[model samples]
Each structure stands twice: as C-alpha cells, then as structure tokens.
Target: MTLELSEPADVDLEAVRRVARAGEPVRLAPAALAAIGRRRAEFVAFVEAHAGDHLYGITTKHDVAARTVLDDAARAEFGRLLPPTPPSPSTLGPALPERVTRAAVLARLTDILHGTAAIRAETAARLTTLLDGPLPAVPEGGNGDPGDVVALGRLLRPAFQGTLEVGEGMALINGSPMASGVLADAVLSGRDRIARLEQVLALAAVAACLPDMHVDAQLGVLWGDPHQERVLARYRELLAGGTWPRRAYQAPVSFRSAPRVLGGVLRTLAHAQDAATTTLRAASNNPVFVGPDLRPPLGAVLSNGGYHNPLVSPTLGALAHAWADLAQLVTAQLNRLTDPPDGIAAHETEPRTSLFPMTASGWAEQARAAAAPGLVGLGRSGQTDTSTPDVLAWRRATDAGAALDALLGLLAVTATHLVTRRGDTPPPALAGLRDAVLECYPLDTPPLDVAEALDAVLAHLAAR
Candidate 1:
C-alpha cells in the first residue's frame, strides 16, 4: 500500500493498527503518500525561500543555541554535525532502533499531515520510502527517549547527510507519534490478552459444567439491554434443554452478570481506541506549521507542549495496568472452571466403605468428607469442623475471579469486533453483550492477533 499523505484526522485506529500489525514493509495509501510528498515539498520550498535568512536551524543556530543564527553556507555543516551537547539523564532506558523507528517515521508522516513540523515533502517521502523499504537494524532495550532520539537522528542523518541545517535534528527528535504508537501497540497487545481470556472463559465453562450448562439468558441481556424482551428471550434459551435449575440463578451465579461484566470491558477499549486515533492525527511538534494561510506570528512559532504527549503517557500506563488486570481475571476463571467441586453446588452420590465404598450412606459420608476443606495450611482447623464457613470470603473470591474473566471478555469482544469490520461485516455496538455461547463464538476464522480478536467480536455482532 503506497501512502499518499493527508491530515491525520482522516486516519483511524484501524489504520494505525494495520501498520503496527503489519510491522514491516507497510504501504501507505497512494493518497496519503502523495500528501506526504506535497508536505515535504512545502518544507523544501520554505528552506529555499529562507536560505539567506538567519533563521535558526535552517541556516545557523540549533539545539540550545538555536537563538544564535548563522547566515553562511558553511553553517549548513551544522546539519551534518552530531549533537555536541551532553545527553540528559533518563530512566526510560535506551531508544528504539530502526524497527521501532520505522513506526516513528510512519507516525511522523501522520503528524506532517496534521500540517505541523518541518519535514520537507520529498524528505518526508524519502523517510516513508525508507519505512516502506529496507530499514536499518535498531538495538532493542535501553532508554526509549535517547534511543528514539539517536534512532531518528541516524535515520534522518543518512538522508540529510552533510547538508543538515540547525533545527533539523530537533525536528526529528521532538514529536509524539513514536510514543503514541507505543501506547497504541500497548492497547492492541492488552486487547489481545483480553481476547485470549474470553476464549479461556468459554473453555472453563465447558469444563466446570458437570452436565452442559446454558448461559443464554446471561449473554442475551448483555447483547441488547434496552430490549427487555430480548433479554428474556435469552433467559428462555438458558432454560431450554431441560438441563437447568428450576429457578434462574445468577450463573456460576456470579456469571449471571456476564453481560454487564463484558460490556464495561468493551466500553473501555472503545475509549482507548478513540484516544489512540486522536493522537494519530494530532499536530504534535514544538515549532509547528500554521500553513501559508495563517497569520505571521503563529505560522512559524515554536510553542511548548504543542507536540506534547499527555495522552500517550497516561494511556500507556493505563494499558499496562489493564494487562495485569486481564491476566488476573482469566487465571481466576480458569481456576473455577477446573474446580467443579468448588464452583458447582451438587454432585452425584457415592458410598464409602472400609474395604469397598458403595452404598448411599457411605457415599454421603465420603461426599461430606470430600466437601470439607481438605486444603492444608488453610487455617480452617482453628474452628470446629461444625464451625460456619466464611461464605462471604468465598463469594468475594468468586467475584474477584469473575472480574478477571470479564477483563478478558472485554478483549475478546474488541478483537471479534475489529476483525468482523475488517472482513466487511457491520459494526457492532461496543456497549452490549452477546446472547449466548454460540453468539460469542461467531468468527468463521480463528483470530490470529489482537486485531483479529476484535474482528471476531464484530463478526459475532454483525451475524446477530
């Protein structure tokens, strides 16, 4: 996919996700490529017009001494010169090399489309080409900031070669796309963890059910909330097969609220998606381009925080915590599903005997004995064997477990949602639940990644 540059506003989460998922040799749409080309041309034209001007980086002064201008052609040597300044102390480890830098280049183009920054369209196109072609190897792990700074410097270094102007280095280093991509990738990765968890939940349900269980009513309410009848219809489905309890019990009792549980996860992912897309199109640079149409002062102005990244930082942090939460949830659901005696209320009877356990009386004794907390170091022995069990703690543990399951369910929902759309399925509501196990597993093709998982969610809903 050849890219034609356009404003970042035109791009979506899916676009960013596509690039990240593709990882290498990502093609920009022809139109976007063209736009980048045009923007690059604009910057070149700016350099040409201001060739004689003592305008900071273009001619003379750069870095901290950017205010000190130089008008001589010898000043062009400044562009080729490596930074003489000392590196700042940082705890972010090292910068990402070319592989990660390629992502930055693509994101930088997005910033260019937002009409901010100083990359010439041809230069930008070159950068894009580099991204689309062979990229240099970047070392993994170290300080992300310096590594990014060095990576971009090295990347642009080849193109700018001996002709780099002053501010050019700064231009490459200061922006938000790289960080935003990290956040975006984090979100995608987190979502993937979630999808896998949902798959786990389904498996757990199957395993825990002594007899097959029906959770249709629970799922139906989630699929469509305002429609009470639809919710009840799902309830009826659960009651079908004559395999259910006489009274509707909150499943796994806690799982009865699966719809609500899953719904929250869907909504959070949607919010994260919106945040990511916004950053993608945002004009993120210090000295921003206001375009020829804008008034003089702000046109060439260098503003602080114009290219700032409050969104990416918090989003990344939130996304990391979300991953932990998701891991906990899936692990819990798996525990319950595998432990039917703990989760299930009843079991078939058997007898216990000294030599041969066979009668109902013996079976009852064994069941009672087995039901007792045989857990060592449980500290339950402090109480009499007849002591009342801590039902509240038991319930709390169950809820905590389900909460984890829901976390994973959210990912599953998002994954299914995205894949379905990519496949040309209708968009599903990001706030509802599916009607049954069958509805949840609507994907014809198994998901291969986070995006695929989201697509599956969408496919399920679209099929509905």
Candidate 2:
C-alpha cells in the first residue's frame, strides 16, 4: 500500500510500523510537495533579504562561535564542511534494521515537508525516492552529538551528491528525526506489548479464578478514571463465563489490583504516544523557518533548539518505569499461582526446579534495572546539552522490547502451568492463548527460547 504523507501529524505509530516493519511504500501528497516548494522559496527570499543577519549554523558558525558571520560563499562552504566536521568511525554491532532506517529517513522527510527546515522540494522528492528504493546499512553507535547527522550523511551521501543544495544537507543531518522514528517504533511496539500484557493479565486472573465481584463494572465507575473504566471493562469481558469458584474472598493484591495496574500502564503508553506524535510533527532543527502560510511569505530564520526534545525523554522514562512495575505485578501473580494458599501445590518440586517462576523473577529483575531513567546525565559535547532524548528514547525502546519479551515469556509459562494444574480446560478468553503457549512450549518438553516464544505469541496476537 502507498502510505501518504500530507502532514507530519498524520504519521502515527501504525504508519511508521507499516513502513518500518511491513516494507510499505511512501509518497508525499501533492499539497505537501506544493507547500514545500513555496516554503523553500520563502526561505530563499528571507535569506537574500537578510544577508547580513546572524543565523546560527547558517550565516554563522554553530556552538561557541555563534558570533562569527559568514558571507554567501562561506555559507555554502559551511554547508559542505559542517556535515563531516564530527566524523564518526563505525563500531561493531548489529546494523540498524532496514525498517528503522527507512522510518528515520521518512521522518526526516516529514520534518522537511513541514517547511520549517526550509529544504528544497527536490530534496524532499529525492528523499522519497531514497525511501522507495534500497537503503544503505546503518551501523550502531556514533549516536552522540552529531552522530545522527554523520550517520545520515554516510547513508545518503551516495544518493544525494549532485541533487542536494546548500544548507539542505545540514538540515537533513542536524535534527532528531532518527530518534523520533526510533521512539515511533517503540510506541508501536509498546502498543503491542500493552495489548499482550492485558491478555496475560486476563489469563492470570481467570487461571487464579479471582472473584468477579471485585472486577464488577460498578467498581470501575467508582474508581472514577477512564483508564480504570476501560481496564475494568476488558477484565469483565475476558473473565465472563468463568465457572470456577473464587480462590478466596480476594485472591491477592496482584489479582485484585490487576485492572488498576494495567490501567496505569495504558495511560502511560498513551502519554508516550502523544509525546511521540508531537515530536514527529515538529521542526526539530536548529534554525527553524517561521512565516505566514502564503506566497512571498515574510519570515525570519531564527536560531532555536527544537531538536532537544524535553517531552520525549520523560515520556520514554515513564514508559520504561511503568513496564517495570507491570513486570513486578506479573511476577507476583506467578508467585500466587505457583504457591497457592490452599495447600494444593501447583509445582510439587522445589523453587530451583520450578524454572518458570525463577525465570520470570530473573526477567523482572532485568527489566527493573533497565528501567532506570536514561535522561540522567550532565550532558556531553561542547554544547553541554544535559539531556539526549534520542539516545534515551533508543535505550528505552530497547528496554521496553526486552521487558515485553520477558513478560510474554512469563505469560506463556503461567498459561502452561495453569493448563497443567486444571487439566487443559482453560477459560474461553485464554483458550487461544493456551493453544499458542502449548504450541510454542509443549508440556512434555522444556521451554524454548523466551525471545522466540515471544515472537510467536506476538505474531499470533497480530494475526488474531
């Protein structure tokens, strides 16, 4: 399918996911191309009218030497020279997945289309062609300072040699779109993880046979939050027709508070989504173009810091921390299932032999450690910018991915144990999940790789 990009705000998680994961084609709407052309002309007029004005990184040097002014010839030289200034050597690691690189390229293109970066319409069209064609391999590391710029230059220099104009290369390289794309992918992944988490929580609740009275719809109303209402509604739907008697008046805090806990996660994921959407639509370059939306638009090329994203850093940190909390809750549910209070031991063997619980605990610990905020630093580079939202969002995405894997593993193990204890008759809501679990990890055999199992479960859920 041809994914349309008429406005940056229209590019959401699913849009990025389709291109990044599904290899879908992308196109700029006719209106976007026209607006880009007009904006580029306006920027040129503004530049010619204000030739003596000091513009950071455009008419003048960046960083501490902002006072240095450059003539038109020098400005052109600056564009050519600045991209290679922070030459980054490649390091050893897996290259960024093609989907992510494509998403980043498209995201940068989206920013340029917003007309704030003042890139030429032809440059935007070339970028679209690059996205439509094969992309160069992007190595990991070199993500500090202008590392993204350097990496982008390396990736696109082969294609954009004769096509790009002055200052456009810097505009392409000097923003946080790569990081925005990374966060966009994370948001998509997090949406999947959140859905999976809800499924597992429902499975655990039904497996434990917690009393339906506590999860009543009235309780959701009394809770007085949209998140609680939504979660309670889902729990009620999932736990419907469960015939098993309650294990106790209240099973445990984990079982009782399942809706509330998952609700918090859902809310935080929404916040992350909002932050990512705003960043996706924003002009994250140094000197943004500001003018009225008309021909011969009067505007100024003023220096700004839209690239340093304050919203994404905290949103990512919150998502990581929220997932960690959910991990602990899942771990607690596992404990309850393994060691029920009624003396009916689910696992007759010792805790060491009971690999499921032990594995879940280990995964939970790793998630908690990974949840530490990535924004805690005094900043680096000569600019001394304290927070690196790009790096933080990347790390947070990794952490959230790992946590999702571990959570899926725990859910599979929990579902398997529940089936074993109850003689293969899982509740209707969990019947499909049970089948998936057993297929990935048969009862007679040891569990497979958790990551592999997670991939299967995610695929299963997506297919459903």
Candidate 3:
C-alpha cells in the first residue's frame, strides 16, 4: 500500500515500519506540497531582501569560516564549490539495505514538507523521485565528527546533481536524516520484537504451567500500573481454560513477576515510540525557518541545533536495557524449566546435557552486554560538538536488534524443551509456536543449531 504524507503528524511508527520493513511506496499529499511552496516562497523573499546579510552556508563559508561574507556572485560560486568532497572512506561497508535507504529519504522528505527546511516544493518532488528509484549508498566508519555529514553529503550528492538549487543541497545533506531513518526503522523493528516477546513469554508461562494467580483481576487491581494491568489481561487471555497442573504454590520470581517485568518492557516501547515519532516529524536541520504568520510578513531563517537528537539515544538505550531484563527473565525461567524442583527430571537426557542451558546462558550474557547504555557522558570530546546522531542511533539500534535475536533464541529453545517433556501436548494458545519449534528440532534429537532455530522462529513470527 502507498502511504500518503499530508503533514509531519502523518509520519507515525507504523508508516515507518511499512516503508522500511515492507518496502511500501509513499507520496506527498497536495496540502503538504502547498505548505512547502508557501514556506519556500517566504524564505526566498526573505533571503533576497537581506541579500547582503551573512547567513551560514547560504551567504557565507561554513564552520570556522562562517565569519566571512559572500556577495550574490560569490554566493552562487560558493554553491557550486560546496558539494561534499569524497572522503578517505569512500563507501560504507556492506551498504545499508535498500529498505533503510528508502526510509531515510522518506524521512527527509517529511522534514522538508514540514516547511522548516525552506526547501522548494520542487525539491521535495525531486526527492520523492529519488526515493521512488534506487538510492545512493552511504558509507560507514567516519571519524564520528562531521565526517558522517561529509560521508552522507557525498553519498546523496549524486542523486541531486543538476537538479538542486542554491542552499537546497546543504539542507538535504545536513542534520540527522540518516539517524532519523535508521532509528525509525529500529523502533519499528523493536516494536515487532516486543510483540513477539510477549507471545513467547505467554508460551513459556503455559509450558512451565505457571499459575494464573498473578493475572487474577484482584491482583491486577493491587498492581495498579496500566501496563501491568494490560499484561495481566493478556496472560489471562493466553492461559484461560488450560488444564495444565501448577508445579508449585509459586513459580520462581521470573515466572511470578513475569507480568511486571513484561509491563516494564511495554512502558519502554511506548517511550521509544514517542521519541521516534517526534524525531520522524521534526525539522532537524540547521538554519531552520521560523517566523510568525500573524506577526511577520516574511519568516526569518534561524540557526538551530535540532540535528543532535538527545531523545533517540537514551530512548533506544532504555529499550535495550528493557530487552536485556527480559532476557534475564527468560534465562531464569528456562533454568527453572530444565533443572530440579519444578522440571520433569524423567526427561533429562544425554547429548543435550548442557546444550539448552549453555545456549540460554550465552545468549543472556550477550544481550546483557549489548544492553549497556550507549551515548552516555555528553562531556566526552567530539560528542557535544561534532558527534553524529546517525552513528549513535544506528549503533543503539544494532545493539537492540542483537539483544532481541538472542532473547528470541533462548525462548524458542526453552519452549521446545518444555513441549518435549510434556508428552508433546502444548497448551492451545502455544500450539502454533510449539509446532514451529518442533518443525525445527524433532523429539529425542540433539538440539538443532541455536541460530538456525532462532531464524525459523523469527520467520514464523513475522508471517503471523
């Protein structure tokens, strides 16, 4: 389906997911084009009226040379000279997938349509064309300073050649469009993973025969957290009418506190969604247009530092930490399901002695390490002044994705182990996941490769 972008408010997490993950097409709404045209006209008139005034990168040199002023003739010449110079690192290793590149372009288009970047309506149209076609590949491994900007500029320059007007190219290449796109994709993927995690947790609860006590309506009233209440409702829904025997008066903390822990994850997802949606809709360019339609005849262009997105970093870190906590819970539950007191000791067999436990432990450790918050300590050199939000967002997304993968693997393994012990009769709610798990590794066979099993489970979840 084609997504129509009418305004900044239209760029939601689901639209981003459809474009980035599903390769859906997008179009700009007529209202959005009209808004861009109005803003561009106002900005152009303002710039012409103040022709001699020095504007960063518009009528003067960039960075340390901003003090120097250029006349109209020099400004025209400067535009030609400002094309991003190719750096020592020519290409980003294993170029970003086409879906990611498309999402980035769409995000930039949203920024332009918001009418803050002062890009011509035609420029926005041209960008839509570029996004509709193949996008230029962005490079990796910049010095994490303005190097990321330089690299993005070089990558995007090819697409705009012979089509861009003065100051427009800089607007396209500047700021955090790449970061915005990457983070949008990450947030979408994280949301899906969280949903999958919920399903797996429900499956685990049934496989281990966790009591329905925690999800009782009375208990939910005591918990009081909306997120906890939602989780409680979902758990009750998944386990209703199941006749599995409760193995103990209380499951381990991981199982007993499952609703609360998963509720925390839901809260984190909500925060990340808010931050990502804000980033997607923001005009994150330097020298953004600002003026009062009521107070001023022409809007003024003001220098801004909106490109440094402080929210994306911390929000993604929170998501990673929440997923890590989920991993810990999965590990504890898996251990409980395999070792003593609650587990079916009769099912403890050979060749797979440490396989499931070792796999869960290894995955849990990796997830924990990946969950370490990134982008902390703004006092660090280059971060406050020249750090690239794109790089930071990309890394955080990568870490979060990895954590989800490991956690999914652990859950799949544990679910399979449980089904095997219970005479292959899984609860109705988990029947689909049980069948998917068994399809990967049959009964009485040595455990299938953990990574292979994980991929299968992920594919199944995606299909659902």
**All candidates' lDDT scores?**
0.44, 0.70, 0.69
Model 2 weakest 10-residue run by lDDT:
343-352
Q: Give the C-alpha miss distance for residue 252 in model 3, angstroms.
A: 1.1
lDDT, candidate 2, 1-464, per-residue tens: 88888887767677788888888888889899899899888887777777687876667766666687888887777655434534445665567777778878877876676677888787787778877777987765556553256557667777766555555766777777777777777687788776667777887776677787878889878988899899999877776664555655777898888889888888888888888887777778867777665433578775666666666667777877887787888888777777755311444444423666677778888778868766535656666455464654566556755765666666655655564556645567767777787676554443335446546665665554
Model 1 lDDT tens row, 1-464? 53344557644555555554665444445676566556555655665666665554456554446556665555656655534433433343343434345556667766666656655445555556676565554333322331234444545555656544444555555555665555555455445544444443433332333222344455445566433333334333332332211233233543444334444455555566777777767776755655554644223534445444556544443443333343444444433432335321112111100111112123233222322221111222321122111211122222333333344444344233222323322112222343233264443324334334444554543333
What is the number of residue pairs that collide in model 1?
Answer: 64
RMSD, candidate 2, Å: 3.2
Mark the regions of model 2 whose C-alpha exceeds 4 Å error after superposition. Answer: 80-82, 146-151, 161-163, 292-298, 340-353, 380-387, 446-464
| lDDT of predicted model 2 | 0.70
Which model scores highest in TM-score?
3
Give the per-residue Cα lDDT of candidate 3 at 84. Answer: 49
Clashing residue pairs found in predicted model 3: 92-139, 92-140
Q: Rank candidates by TM-score, best first.
A: 3, 2, 1
Instruction: For candidate 1, report its TM-score.
Output: 0.58
Q: How many residue pairs clash in each candidate?
A: 64, 0, 2
TM-score of each: 0.58, 0.88, 0.89
Tens-place lDDT per residue, model 3, 118-174, is 777877877777756667765555525442365456557776765655567567766
